[model samples]
Target: MSISPLKETIPKLDPPNNTSLHPPPSPSTHRTLRRLKSAHVLGSSVSQPSLISQQHKQSLNRNFSPTRKVTNPPPGAHTRTRSNSDANVMSPALSSPISRRPQMKRASPVEGSTLDRLIRDGPTEGDLERGLESMRLKILDQGVKSDGDGMSSLRIYVWLVLLNAPVLETDEYLSLIHRGASPAYSKIRNDTFRTLATDPLFRRRVSEASLIRLLNAVAWKLHDAKGERSEVQMRLTNTANIYGSPELQHATPAKGRSRATTLTNDGSDAGKSEPGTYVQGMNVLAAPFLYAARSEAEAFIAFHQFITTECPGYVRGAMDGVHKGLALVDKVLAIVDPKLSLYLIGKGMNAELYAFPSVLTLCACTPPLPEVLRLWDFLFAYGAHLNILCIVAQLVILRNSILNSPSPTKILRSFPPLQADIVKEVTLTLVKKIPDDIYAEIVIHAK
Candidate 1:
């Protein structure tokens, strides 16, 4: 997949078993989060005015944070060039009025329990001890009945408890983790200990000092973009990174696209229903992912929060319309091509939004940054394809459950925000049941 292959056909690489991990950025993909950083590579400007960076070919990590309030796109900017060298593409443009260019040059640890739990410590020693104890009990209980599927099973149990907290007792759920209710409950306890310590929600209840203290446990990841090799530092191993063919990267989103006008989406027309399908509240086009109703709302709120409080530069990126337009294209493409879908999940790895510190790790509750860098290496290899496909299929897969699931709350707890594992699992399975020709059919348009 050479960048020079201006107009080339994408190959079909379908096999079967689709195993996904970390469903955060449910509405976005590994690329969406990672793309926010500075890519050293340069593309042949599209059309709109864009800025040219001298830092092309730099395969390093660069964080571009804006400090001002989010503003409109820069008018009359130079167009961003597209290259055939990356899975997801990038170029330079105006900075957001509120862009803070916070160079988190210092790589932190990955902050989740499932993969690499780098503990930075959250508030009281008691909190830490309790959280750890809670996880330990969870592991033992789950492990008691099986050949070691405890932790995985416990993950589901946690999701269910969190999503459908019928009794709404945090301690009960916390107790579930504290006691040996399920196999590997201990592991969940350990992981949750770290997560709860750093969890913003947890911190909110705790003192501000505790929240800041807990963040130290937070880690960072690396992103591979179409930038200069020296610029986009690669961190985190055994994860998804989106620096494949540049043309594919830029084209994957195929700008000028719009959100779903095909049917009643979001809460707007959820009232209307057809025979086989009913309307759900999920916002299928949220940047991080197409999610169940509440998730969509959460994501929208989170994104707006990010746009306002975090990355003002995003508006600048949006100005090129690359962020918003391309994102919309990516969303549309996700539906059109499974491979191009947006779910970019990394199981048991740091779920950093991008592979770089600049992108600002954005998964709901996953591993930290440093460990996430490891994951991006793999992500960048095939991330472009996975970026579009995963997100789209996730929507398709969830559309039914989201729209009509008996227990809608379970949607959030049932799984992590991202669904990379599902993609790997489904693709591998499809390979066997599906003939080569069928894959070819999908791949043809996947480009």
Candidate 2:
């Protein structure tokens, strides 16, 4: 088992500067919306029966199954190495990640999974939150050994995607689920998922294609976590629960230095530092989703500050890209109920922080199957109006769950470190089944 030579292993690049080749920020940011809170529940406006089948058909058509479409780098995507791009852009605020640490060659394929019939058909009469707890219980009932190696492995992948959801501060994506970031899942869900994602021995044992398929299946499974299969509903059930104002939850800023990464690298002579070459020219900009992700991260920081500092609408304008990004959701939801605020706030704001913008974009672009599917369920239901609110809902859910979080700062600080598959699984658990029904907070506000 030999590791690749250090410092010169990432993709290679050679261009004094590739600024001209960069794409604008978030052009597609608003093209879609995600309903993570209630993929199925509180998901109003699904032409009823037309919801799943039609969506499933559309999903089969448009949904780019990572395992399938990731065959080649998308056209014009960066294929450069860190050293080359580093020459142009500044290094990431984060240290070289242990998650991306050198591995001993590509791992061998993991074994295939045989589905576990243990998981019941879907959520029962209970809300999605209850459904999620029920699902957790059901998964637990499987006794670890019930599902063959494949299904267990796949479920782990799904959970990883959920926990690492880019919902709130991306200080440390994985740490939030592990250690006791949010005592809710950290106490139990974290340990269980860690066992699964960290199982590289089993991962490599499975075939590559089979592993990919399993991940996709998990994405599909957790995608609906908030909806029909959801554990709780997205919105309030009673009219009185609908409060008017979007109050504060963890309005208190997370403990950490706020290091904002300006879209453009400083300097007139900036070579590869151009926004266009960020992904290729900068390791910080490696992923295609980073553009929107960076914006989303900034937006969350801004929104948090907005709640506390009540900063001017500058945050709103700054959110223009993602605004249209989520606007599409509202446009679609208006069809469901004109009276709906499109902003699915909960009287629970004092209760918790909903999905952070980070989660809204599903960890920007690296959305695991769970978040993707959860968002897909929401998108299927209310259209675009659901995006930001769902993001908010996701965050609030975390906040609520983490009421006993030992230390948000410690957890945040611990992140941006490892990339274990478990952190992600933990995220999926958070974005679980969307609700089938939800009441509005705004209506409650009026009363």
Candidate 3:
């Protein structure tokens, strides 16, 4: 089915003339900087904003240094001041405002294990794919372990391998964050606070500042890409007009109308607006990466790889990929469990009404955050398209309750908090039941 483009105008995000690419930090940031400087780790201080709160610092410590025991400071600890000389003698981790957390310990693979060798040796693209298949099977049979709070020792590296995410430098991500907020800054701020808002596990571990920074950095990247694409399109349009191409003439908007207001054969506005630079559900999508990643930059790399490659359509104008995925959810559910599918449909319930968040966030919206992480382990392992079948599996698991309920919508309004193991089991079974054609559609629905 053809999806109509959204009618919104793309906002220009070019910085003002006086604004430098690397603007000086604000007063609060300066205080943070001084704190880092005092800790004698000036080099690492530039990696993140200095304004990281005390709570966030502890959370980071907990997530990355899973084995370290964090002790509380004595009362009136905030009132004490340290001299530069005294700070120099203190350990960097103890003195720095944001402690340098250690990377999670890698599981010691068997001496000759294929997965260990692949990870240690860094396989080529073809070899990596083969390695990932082995890894996928291992993950399916024995799931990755995580702290109850969703922090995993090895999950981020696995996700990076599965996504084939490039090795991004800390400076590269810092540069984006240093660019300050993008045109979507206000929109991003609005959604960041609400992301995984009700989940204590997520709330405690991820700082609002960190989430805002990651999303804003992503917005800037998207904004820059959109600008480049627009420039190329404009150049092509100009060249076409100069050549007197009939197709160009037919496609050009009228003098009185902007391209965004132009109508197409589908009777819908043929707008220039691409997928949004910052959409609402993106905060949810980015949350898991931040929760899983060892650092913001690591999270940025994985999250960027995911949106740009795995599911570009999901983030595009009107989230056409997500809508497509939703429709597929209904179809897959019918094939796997026709009784539940028809019962829900007869009650005027459909995937569109209930599965939007699940579709858009890859089931991250449902929580018990650790379970979400486990489910994601599977998604990143197999194929993300399997999430469609996973959603169907959720329905199948809940079939008894839904079929019996007079109002089935209440049961489906939210999936019973994600049961990753059972969901994966049902999903694999459902995968076998899907016809080849429908399964093919499931595979590419997010693309």
Judging by TM-score against the true structure, name the best candidate. Answer: 3
| TM-scores for all predictions | 0.23, 0.20, 0.71
Worst 10 residues of 3 by lDDT: 81-90
Residue 207, candidate 3: Cα error in Å is 0.4
Give the per-residue lDDT of model 1 (tens digit) for 1-447. 111011112223233223443333221221121221121211112243112122123243211100012223359742232111111111112221111111112122223432112011221332322332233222222111111111121122222111111212112111222222232222222333333244343233223222111111110000111122213222211111244332233433433121222211342232121111000111111112111111211222222222222222322312221133234323343345444232332111111222111122222233332222222211222222222233334445565564465443455342334444344334333323333433333222212
In order of listing, the candidates' clash counts read: 153, 94, 2
* Model 3 TM-score relative to the real fold: 0.71
The candidates, ranked best first by TM-score, are 3, 1, 2
Error of 2 at 404 (Å): 3.2
* Comparison by lDDT, 1 against 3, better one: 3
**Model 2 spans > 4 angstroms off:** 1-360, 363-368, 410-447
> Model 2, 31: alpha-carbon shift in Å?
26
Comparing candidate 2 with candidate 3, which one achieves the higher lDDT? 3
lDDT of 3 by residue, 141-224 (tens): 566645456565457666776665654545566567667767888888888888998999787767777788788789888889
